[model samples]
Target: MTTALAQRPPATAAYSPPSYGLVDRVAGLRHHSPGRLQLILTTLLTLGLLTGLVAGLTAHSASAGTADLGNRAQPLMVEAETVYSALADADTTAAQAFLAGGLEPAALTQRYDDDLARAGTALTNAARLVPDDSDAARAVAALSTGIARYSALVATARANNRQVLPLGASYLAAASQLNRETLQPKAQALFRLATDEISAGYDAARSSWWLILLLVLSVALGVALFWSQIYLSRTTHRTFNVPLVAATGLFAVLILAVGVLFANQRTHLDSAAQKGSAPVTALAQLRILVLTERADEALTLAAHGSADKEEDFERASGAIYFDDPRLAYAERFTTTLKDRHEAYLTIHGQVRKLDKSGDYDGAVALAIGEQATTTFGDLTTTLDQAIDNRKAAFTDEIGDAGDGLDLLSVLGPLLAIAACVLALLGIRARLEEYR
Candidate 1:
């Protein structure tokens, strides 16, 4: 029994771990030159293909986004802003024209019509750009309905005023209320929505994630191709592999060219926002505030003894001079506006004094007189010029941003594919020697 137990193998030795022969053979492959070359070739080809495809898709997507911003998104946003500004001007013109008495001045009448025409054109353009299901479209629809009603009210007010009816003032007030309370709010909403869409588009145009992945894969592929050349040079006593060298040079140039294109696009986008869109929006708001102030001046004379008249004027003045933001491009205009505003305000104070002293007729003349007209008109004209200038700048910058993007989108994939073919040819030459 003792002999039999001693002859038995130990428990650990009785069952040996089974050899996975295929896996062992595969694992041992790294020690051979052919195996090493195969590994390098496979890695380089995989990286090249992945980098190429991802780079192509990312370029296409970014180019599409840039084009959308320039052609569709930004134009829509600017049109909405223009609609907002024109509507406010029309409301102000209608109010002041009412105060100009029975027939109203022909100049003022023409101005009111022009303001409406401008607003209508901008609204039509915005509507064409926005999708029917979007909030911007709904806002446009609301403004269309509201403007018609507001215009009808103003017409009724003018008719009653021609006959010197007391109801004329009430109709005018109703028209102003509809414009300020309803129409302007809807226009502003459309502007906000359009701005949001533009912001999203800018982000889509500069997809950093895709670019980052491309850069990483490109470096890996480049390194593998380079190392394979070194390995061949050492093993085969050859100093250079032409195809591999060419592949490396092609990839390097691709990275540099694309890097520059992306960087330029980013710069143009930033300039568009800073020097164009941002300043344009700020100046538009300022102009609207000025228009509201002018309306208050006219409406106060048309119907006095209101508690909020002077307070509203002061609030608007505060916003224009202190509360409202100013941009670099608008600095000169802002200064001119403030100086002109002070002169207008001085005239306004004199008009108020006469009205309080019971010279209502004289007060009306000074309020709508030549001096008041010139000062206000100058401010409006200058503001319009500034807005136009910024808009032009925006167009130019956006155009530059979108330039060459389409070519790059197509070129990226072709270059990567070419690089891969060269790498394969280079690797096959080494592989043929072993076979």
Candidate 2:
């Protein structure tokens, strides 16, 4: 037996099993291994990446919204308004020139030419801005063709008038109808489309609720990590981990800064929509009304006692020179316009009476000569002043809105990257201490 035990490697150290207390087993179960630390680091880094991605996306979206509102939408809206105004003014000028007969004044002819040039330029600008297959694009193309046709008609009318032919009146009437019925409505539709796009941009800028929620969750994760660091300090009986603390501070500041920037951007956009776009649009509509009335007045004489033209003039004048309860504060400006317009209607009435009584020379003198000085001329001055005032208001409000959003896109992604770097450094430092 002794020889056998010696041969069995000295009996294997008495054969007693290792002892383990309950506390030791429980501790082993609870303790994190190196692999667990790696897992925790991976999870933290993933969260950091997610947060950064979300921040970058939100920043990009906001930046795009800002650009659309201030750069694309507002400018398009203004251009559309320009087109409408130019077309209306052109029709009115054409009518005024016709009333001057074959010997139209140099100033009146020059004004007509200027209006046509402005309309063409505005149409080209609008076409460049709109998408290729869009309704706005189609409208612009159609208007281009229509303008060519109307010009040809106007030229024919001028030639016939120089030869003392009554057919000039019929040509002028057809061109005016084309402007009133087709071109004006198309321009209005384009304006509406541009305004709709502006509204969409405003909505996009304001709608950041999902981004805000994601940021809140990211902040919560940061707080949890901070608390975990504190727990580790207590359990390990070591000083605080500085890097983790720094990461937490950086994350918090990022959230706060982003929140502030988003809030300010939203405020500025709202102000622009309300104070800038709204007032300018109202004034533009008012300008169209004035141009319509002027066209009606001239068309009445061009039609030579056509009751239809007289009725149209009266209807347009009523809309322009009356208080509209639906328009609210806009009524105040219209009140001033109304006073000037009433004076015009009085002279127009006298001119019509002279035409009906066979006093054709007197009617022509009042309609297009020095007698128009106190009536149509004064009305034109009033409309010009109103347009200038509204334009200034639009410029100031839109400019402020645009300036507020300058730094948001750059700062957002930068801060996100900083937070991610800080988090990785912090976790790596804590892991090194464990190793």
TM-score of each: 0.85, 0.80
Q: lDDT of all the models against the reference?
A: 0.81, 0.70
Number of the predicted model whose TM-score against the real structure is largest? 1
List RMSD in Å for every model shown: 8.4, 11.3
Model 1 spans > 4 angstroms off: 1-35, 159-168, 322-326
- State in Å the error of residue 278, model 2: 0.4
Q: Residue 33 in candidate 1 has what lDDT?
A: 85
Enumerate residue pairs that collide in model 2.
none
Per-residue lDDT of model 2, residues 191-220, tens digit only: 888888778877775557657856776776
RMSD (CA, angstroms), candidate 2: 11.3
- Candidate 1 backbone collisions, by pair: none
